[model samples]
Target chain A: MADTNETVLDMEVIGALRALEADGAPGLFAEIVELFLTDTPPRMKGLEAASDAGDMPGVEAAAHSLKSSCGNLGATVLVDLFKQIEMLGREHAPEEIPSLVSKSNEEFVRVQSALLNTK
Target chain B: MRIQDGNDPNSVGEGMDRHLARYHELKDSGEMPGLSLPEPGNRVPASSAADGKLRDEIIVQLCEGVADERRVQRFREAWTKTVEIVSANRSGICERFPYDEFWSHSLACGLAAHALSKQLGRGNAEEAFLCGFFYRVGALALSCAFPFEYAELMELRSLSELDELKSVERDLFGMDHVETSHAILVDLRMPDLLCATIGELAGQADGGRSELAYLVLNAEKIAGVCLLDESRGDEEWSAIMEMRRELGLERAEFAELGDAVVRKWWEYGDILKIHTRAVTTFLELDDTGITERSLLGLSKINAMSEYGSPLTVLIVDDDPTARVILKQQLVKVGYRVLTANDGADALSCALQHSPDVVIADWMMPEMDGLDLCRALRRYEAGRLLFFVLLTGRGEDEGIIEAFEAGVDDFFVKPTHQDVLIARMTAAKRVLNLRRQIEEDHRQLKQQLCRMAELAREAKDAAVTDSLTLLPNRRYATRRLSEEWSYSERTGLPVSIVMIDVDRFKMVNDTHGHDVGDVVLQRVAEVLREATRSGEVVCRFGGEEFIVICRATTREDVLLCAERLRSAVERFVTEGLAVSEKITVSAGVATRDETTGNVDALVRAADQAVYKAKELGRNQVCA
Candidate 1:
């Protein structure tokens, strides 16, 4: 038995892949994971720099990008976390951003490993 | 404020400027509120260099309020650039549009209104900005619609008596600029709240002045003092004082706000290529509220009237005298009218105003009305701008060219008043039909988008199993033949695996169907994970399943079958209703030269599955 927090497969992505039977081709699930892994780092840095500079517009742009991408990849927990950061970037205090960003980074590592394990 | 028909025509502006000076004499003496608006003279185009393209930053700056979070953004973007280009270039207007004065004044008034809107805490800053900038739009539409008579009215600027311009407009065109503008904006589908607010300036609102119009009036005068001739300072100061008394705006706070707007304009004025006579320091001010041009609260958008809005008519003729008579008749019978001197002016006015019908002289200078009709057709497909040429040439060949060039209907020159009016009335039906068609098309497109979404959902539902959300037996059955045909073409053996939940009925009996459902779902998940990309798995009714393996020989099929059997055995049933281990039996078969058909191959897999079940559960058979 696997712990809920451990790198276990998400049935949703596997189910989506099951529907698409393109023989001898790399599945959509792998490509989506690869895309998310590549897309998250620059965005995380952008959120950090924008928060540090007190640039609400930049923070909002970066947060919005991260939120949608995470939502599309079925990173629901990370998506919710990113949505909080995005709302903050739109209004209210930036002081709370660092903790959220770190939490997002930690959770994404689990998501990344779990997605890779499915391969 | 009303003006008595004094001998001096200049008294219209002169009387208002002198209203406070002669307060006792004029306060109780004046009859009504007249058109005391400042008429900005023609621009002396900048000597250095002039360009055509209106840069994006100007809209960002000028429409700062209106553009910020308003849903009317597409209109805002287009309107801002239209305003900027009309203000920036002198030649463009002299050629196309008839009225070229006071646009800079309009922008200044908009800026001042935006500044004041912020000060007053009025939530609709962008709307105020747009309303202020475009306050004088009615004046332009009227003057352009009847150039000759309007030019004569311009000479009457000294007569401080044309209190609403409604009377002078009534005498001449039978309708004033305010009425003309209301119809124009309504046709443009402008926010009704905005239209209602501007209606205050027309002195036609049921109540006195709307709060928005009061702020615009004060801000406009303040801007006039700062940007216009220094001689207008006394009038500006008096106007500001009166607005302060009326609106409760204090001088010091307003001075700060007005100065801020003037200073802000300097920072980006040159970049936007805006033409301005130095607006040095803001005059001592008194006002409230700011109207950000593009950013306004979305709440208060008047339920736009799509169908019943009045139609706009553009009158184009080289003879300004003839245009005046034509405009008077159109305005008399209640039509929102715009007029131009030639084809150039007519085309520009038609595009900017988007009038429902264009009435022009057939033989005018620089692109006759027929040629103008052809040029209009190039703008957007499917004849939105209706063209009617007034031609003396009723010859067969000329009429053919006019019709070929897309003239809707024609009025021969020196047309009878009743006859032309009747023609206009008939044209109204066609125009209304076009509007209805446009409304229908817009609704149909939205319906198509919804239907496409429903179709996507339906397609998803059709292919997936309800319980586990895996492909069902129907999907697997379809994929089997597809794989078999592909295998035949490539000479690659196709394999099948018949899977069954070993003693599924016993699991259900022991733990109930809830636990049975969980067991079946768990087994499906494990099988899905074990299978590679080229394999298809389906629930073949209760407890039974199938997998189609493409381009795979018997050996690979056997390995895949053993993997699925082991995976189902290892599936975790902890915390589930099932107490016993969950497992599935798999039987593998492959297509070969000896296999007669896909049915024979499937029968072989069925026999293999029964053998696996007979060989005691939780084992693979090949």
Candidate 2:
């Protein structure tokens, strides 16, 4: 795989790394990635349950919060996937949401592995 | 004194009793009882012709007195009031007032008075007012004196001839009211000119009269005939027509003046606590004689009507309320309106709609009006949008900035609505005129653009060497002039370098112009590649080329020139298929401030080139 620097990532990813270094924890990216990896699954499960129950507001609230967190972490692809989920949840289209959540999970695993491997 | 009727027969005494009885009988009959029993102080009986003469004299004297500066000034206020009143009631009077005799007479009297005053150089404008007021005083007095007979006469004659039958007053009252009034005026010692005019007006004497007085008298006569005709007889109508021509009154103008006079009478009567209908009738009777006054009044009415028309406006402001207020006020004034919100919107709207003019606000959120104004200048939208920047900021800097940004005009915010409407109206007119001017400008710009493109094409064709695609001699001169100016401004040394193909004609003669052309192209490529972007390199016609370098020192210019010469030599020998090896002689000259002319700079470079050629044509010289 190409390095993150060579890939077209959101500009905020650099800003987040710089912020972590400025906060006196230059090697804290792995811990933050682990936190995201551990926290996002339960949120996704909650969204799925709320959407299955036809609770559109619940689905929206969960999806929106998760999406913003992913954006903050500079996980642009995940953020885009979460945004689509939020839109779908708000629009009450729960039937087409499983595949999107699966894709987000897969991308999250990749980002998590990459973070764990960082020197 | 007592009288015994058949119903109340009481006995009375001799001669004194007989006179008393006669006076009582006259009083019982509602006649002028005092005529039979005169007042104790009266030494003279009221003769009809004398009184008529006196009334005429009094009227003339009154008119003359008003001509005096003091009296005229006093009357001017009254005249203005009369005009205001008449204007206010114009529609009402036109609807209600009698169209025939009375209205015509009043208009005639007003005109006659104006004419007389003008002829006499009298400053009293109120003469028209007064003439309209009292022209029919004689007729009114007669009506009062013989009420029963006048009522009978009014009934017997048609509505048009009320004034004409006044001659019958002599038969009924033993003296007409015109004579009676004249006598009273003479008794009061009025001026003789006045007395003579009254006599002329009353037909009491064949005296010399002013044309205005005659016009008034004729108007009155025509007015009376018009009143008497129940069906408004054609004969009376013809007489009125003749009177109109005689007074030089156009028919429409006569009607308008007549209506104005009636309106004035109605208004004045209301003010003075008199009967409005009665007063109107009286004035209308007088207007019949002076047809020109009616014509004058009509022209004035037409003028007033014209002034009542609405203006057109364009409102430009970011604030909705400002636009609404401006639009409302302008609409009230009968103005057509257009509105734009901000500078960019205003500009686009102005360009698209081509409004009569633009009223723009300065402090807009996006694209301030000044920027929009500057942009508008590039368009031939006629008179450059006639931009008016309405600003709350009154700083000199802001104002200066607006002007610098190409605002044609400026207005402070919270301008009076009326003033704004007026200004916008004026702006609209100017912009409309500019529309034509802008159309002409568009045509001219189109023409100029076409010419510029053609010139550019021609220049490209003439000044580019075909094979190398480098500028020829014509372009070299142009580049030199520009470079010379740039050098002067920056005080930086500019250098011109000239290079020539050594034996270039021989190459062309041996290999033909085609290969020679190829060689030239290759040399140009090398020179272009070696030179900085800021430098100008051109084929200086045939096998010679020139380069202009900005901000270059003398040594730098020489080095660059030498490098180019070496590159051309190396490329031709190593890379090109040539029968003979090629080399170039170069010359470089830096601009000298002491001799700042481009021609001089070129000459120096040319001399250097000559020197290089003298030194065996393969090296650079400066």
- Maximum-lDDT candidate: 1
Docking quality (DockQ) of candidate 1: 0.01
The deviation in Å at residue B547 for candidate 1 is: 92
Q: TM-score winner among the candidates?
A: 1
Worst 10 residues of 1 chain A by lDDT: A17-26
Which ranges of candidate 2 are over 4 A from the true structure? A1-119, B1-67, B70-132, B158-160, B184-193, B204-208, B218-238, B249-622
* lDDT of model 1, residue B263: 45
Per-residue lDDT tens digits of candidate 1, residues B1-622? Answer: 3323442426434422222222223324541112122223333332334222334444454455454456447545435444434544332211233232355566677778877777787636666777777676655654544446566776666211234466777455434555454544544456776667665565544566667887787677666644444444345455656765565666665555665665445333443434544332333232423211110011101111133333567888665435545564554343556778888666655655577788887766467878788876655421676679875423235787778888888886545556876777668767667778977997998898567758967775455676776898778877888888998899988999999988889876654555577677777787888889988899878888899998888999999999888877776454333447777788999999999887898899999999988989789998
* Residue B419 lDDT in candidate 2: 63
